[model samples]
Target: MGSKQSVLQENGYTVMSEQHNTIMLKNKDGDQFIIKKLKADQNEASDFLQKLNHPHIVHHKEIIKDGDCLYLVMELCEGGDVSQKIKQTATFSEILDWTVKICMALKHLHDQQILHKNLQPKSLFFTACGTIRLGEFGVIHEWSSGAQITNPEALSYIAPEILKGEPYDEKS
Candidate 1:
């Protein structure tokens, strides 16, 4: 479980796999989690997770820091992302169910004044029990009033007004 520079071993999580800067781990109780080492000092995602409590949102267990790496311990979605699930054969009811779940999650986020700037197929994950959960809050923004923010990294999912560089509210 010891990588060249990872401290997951000290935290009681066994390394399952490593990809680039992220590692998948599982604890002794058989609970799996994903650990992502951030390259910068950012707490937006952690803050959002801590403030949110919904069934359709991915859960954040804890955050660990070892030297320069910031490891985010999150619930492991065994069913993977929705994009992969959509590519497979599914019933109409199943599709509708997933859509409703996503809408519920979005409504919750919006009610909290949190905008998921990066809304895409990859950001939608499914838990082991097949519950849809919205994830990937790296580009989430907290909005109030008519404030506008820019997200060049989320070009694919960015709204039209945002792409046009227009100052828009949370609806955009």
Candidate 2:
């Protein structure tokens, strides 16, 4: 968390932007990486990163720990997410375009048997060329039928069955 100074890299080091609990690295190849610290027993996070790989999802480049803080080096979405972009543009078409792309990404995940339980505007990244991509599937999962209940974050996108305290079909 110092003024853009040279930081550690593979075999060498590079200068990066330092945030509160995260660091943004500008790799020698001109690629930007957002590294953040991880809490203890983050096996779920580690598993999600290893299991899921999609074009719409942000890439997990590396995982490092400088001292006690664990760093998850991920591809930095330069233009920010859909919500941030929409805040600047009040047009319906812009919102539609972003939603379509985001929905497509969601459908893709569903096809892979993965549910992105947290599907908020902030989690949908937007590009300059008007594209919406999903990010942060750390809490994503492929649950089996007739499973026990848990995870309150998923309640927002819950289906009718779940609302009625019935077994939830994640694919639905």
Candidate 3:
């Protein structure tokens, strides 16, 4: 939406520790940017956000700290979330375009050893030019030791092995 001033005014109060909400802000030069505050102690989120380098994935600009709030500034996407466009497409071609983006995002995450426990349509924020970006790292879960991931994710996307009362490790 709106400019940095408006977004900050509305969302600034919630921009504190444990707040996962994303906001819009501007730099010293008046350049608009997107900022998502990751949870403190979430090393996996910090690591993933730092290593991300895909075009389809949101750009990882830099980490900033304002008092106690930790912010991750990223490239802004203007198409809004893909969930907003699904209902308007009456043609197969248009639908395919969105599908391709969704797949690309998944592929990018998997390739990077990161898994999004919440991979819903709403997570796919689209751009004005139809580019799709995978975000919302608050749902991202990964292994701290780079070992096999046997932990259950958010039940919605939890692996079958993890749902069967099997042994799972959070640091997998």
Which candidate ranks first by lDDT, i.e. highest?
1
What lDDT does the true structure give each of the candidates?
Answer: 0.78, 0.62, 0.62
Q: Give TM-scores for every candidate, taking all chains together and pairing residue i with residue i.
A: 0.84, 0.67, 0.68
Q: Which candidate order results from sorting by TM-score in descending order?
A: 1, 3, 2
Each prediction's total of clashing residue pairs, residues at least 3 apart in sequence or on different chains, is 0, 0, 1
Cα deviation of 21 in candidate 2 (Å)? 3.3
Order candidates by lDDT, high to low: 1, 3, 2
lDDT string for model 2 (1-172, tens) is: 3222322564233646676666777667776677665664564555566555666677677665444445677777777876677678558986776667667777776776666656666677754454556885545656542332355665665565645756544555
Candidate 2 overall lDDT versus native: 0.62
Which residue pairs collide in model 2, if any?
none
Per-residue lDDT over 1-172 for candidate 3, one digit per residue giving the tens place of the 0 to 100 score = 4543444545433222222367766655555677776555654477677788876777778765544455677777778886687777537886687678767777777777666655566667766676778766665756333223333444555555455645444322
Model 3 segments more than 4 A misplaced? 1-20, 66-68, 143-172
- Candidate 1, residues 1-172, lDDT tens digits: the string is 3453347777788888989767788998988898767744556556677678899998888887665666888898889897899999978999899999989998999898888877888889999889999998776667742223444555777788766766655577
